[model samples]
Target: MSNSQQSLGDYGIDIESNPESQDRQDPHTIGILGSADDYAPHSIDREGLPNINGFDWEVQPVQYGPAEILEYWRLDGDFHDGLSHEKIPGSGGIIIRGADDYLREHALTEIEVPDYYTRFENEETHCRWSADGRTHISWRFLKRAVRLSNGYGRIDPVTTRVILCDTGHLFVSGPRGAFLVDIPPGRIFRNGDDLPEPPDSVYETIRGIQVPEENPELRTAFERYFRLLSESPYPSPISHAGFNGADHVLETTSEKTVVNDNNLKVLGGQTKPFEDTVGVYSRQCESTNFVVSVDPMHLPGEIGEEVTLSDDITSFGSSGDTTGIITGYRTNWREEDHIAPSSSGVSTLHFNLIVGLIMPDLTVTRRRINVATFEP
Candidate 1:
């Protein structure tokens, strides 16, 4: 068989030797042309290829989805080897990209945190403070995600370093900068014996006077009196009254009245008797007396009369002879004594007396005096 005829098997077709079978089976067959001009091939041009017809072949600009966008900005040649970002599921238009670079440049260092304290995952838009409680860091991207998915996209943990101020407070570092965190106070355990005792000087002891119970009424009265006296700016006198008194005369006489008569008896003549009075004894007498009495049925008028010294005297007749005038008088009764009969049922009366006395020279002298009396 000729080479072209043997290649028919390669094309998966066999030519029939019978002309009638060929006509029946190969109905669409075209007859060979007698000349090359009768059958011409289509032209093959390079207009659509690079550097063909003066055209410069280059990669076309294309839009990327959320995941591919992250890879593009990552700048890593290996697209699958770096950190990636994606939109949170049902987050609407929010997107985050290039978080790995942001955290690597700005986040707090793992060495700065103690092993006891946990370091949170470096997810986009998330932040954490160092264990030393000084540096603050966070990261996020503004680009919207082209694809929707739950949570942050697959992110690889990145090592970060931060220089923090020794403020003794929690802080985080991020692209924006470091900021303070208000950490809440933590509870601490303690033992009952660990409590401290108060100083002895802080405690005080008070001692009170023990009063006898036998005379409670007297004690109460005294206490009331003392309290009233302390509160009063000027305490009133216990008793005040007015009265008058009679003044008495004093006289002096010679010791010898008839001594000369005996010495002249021998002279047979009676000697003149010697009688001499040095001064006259005539003087105005004034006297005053104060009397206080307690009577259960005592009338108010009686008390008033007694204090004023207006009580009638037997010597002073019904016409009433006034020997002396009263200047002032005051009376005080112990109410407590009346209320509590066990107490002293005593009333006080004071009398002030003004008296006129005649001296040896016959000059009238006036004297004023005061007296107080109590009765029960």
Candidate 2:
């Protein structure tokens, strides 16, 4: 077989409209356009990839797919083979061309996360700090997989270096170079108490929207909410409603602390104890109440012991006022309170979030370096 043929068949992914595959997946196509003529023999060179954020990323080349497949991968290009191949982002691993390929896959391997990365605030987009003085970075890891469509439609593990940034940018190293994953833009609803009503229109409440007929009463409430949304001026009502719902939940629930993987912190107070925890400066505003549940095992003092922020801990650098006292430590650590490292073959050391004070000026934050297992 020629190099082109070898490359295409090597990974067991076929772009051509196979009769058998077509019959099976008639309703949903993998967004592949044109024929074999749209594909040209392209070899990827993986040498000299620059180090991003102080770590050398070992990026894998695009295991040759037709140019049209790039679009299915949400890459920024068209189906023309004549487009520049010199600048395709390294795929880090094999390409799973489409949603059909994703469905056919069997299992996914947990993504190994890079330790030395930070999710800081982009003032243009999000808040600068959390209720605590520390900066919170939103991030999560997912499983990577690929499927062989032409073969027995077998699923196999593949590496796709997916990095979630704080500024709502998702970078995936795929068929092309590192490209931004497209996410629908959302407007932030700061106040949960006030939900805006939808715009006025002459349609029954959620008239066309599909809801389960079994739960008429529940459906009625949903219709009421949908009516409110239908009358709203927001372009993306679903996304807007989601944000509003979260805010509403926070408002109604007694547990005002919104702790998730994104905002969870391991305030070890002293950073030297945990190799997986990195110290960061989080913001602590006067208006927000800074409270944390302490895991005493990670703390230097007893549960009731009051420690001065400046004199007791080295986690938050010496820049802020250290006179603040952290008292009434509550040992309320949950399962999701800890974080582990992401790189391969590291004896997994789980680090729990520790209790620390929201100092007047300096609120030190520590984040987990490990990537969480993929959910879907």
Cα error, candidate 2, residue 148 (Å): 21
> Each model's RMSD to truth, in Å?
58.4, 21.1
Q: Per-residue alpha-carbon lDDT of model 2 for 1-376, expressed as tens digits?
A: 0111111223222222221211112212322212212121133333422222211222343322222122222233365444432222223222223322232221111123332223211111111111121111122111121111111122211323433322222334422233332222332323431122211210123445532111122334334333332443322123112112122111111222222211213322222332233232222233332233223234444322234443333432455434322321222212222234553432222223443332222222322211112111
- How does each model score on TM-score? 0.12, 0.23
Estimate every model's Cα lDDT from 0 to 1.
0.21, 0.26
lDDT of 1 by residue, 25-136 (tens): 1211212112211111111122421121111222321211211011012122355454343321111111123223222222221213211112322221111111121111
CA deviation > 4 Å runs, candidate 1: 1-165, 175-177, 190-376
Looking at model 1, report the run of 10 residues with the lowest lDDT sum: 240-249
Residue 8, candidate 1: alpha-carbon lDDT: 27
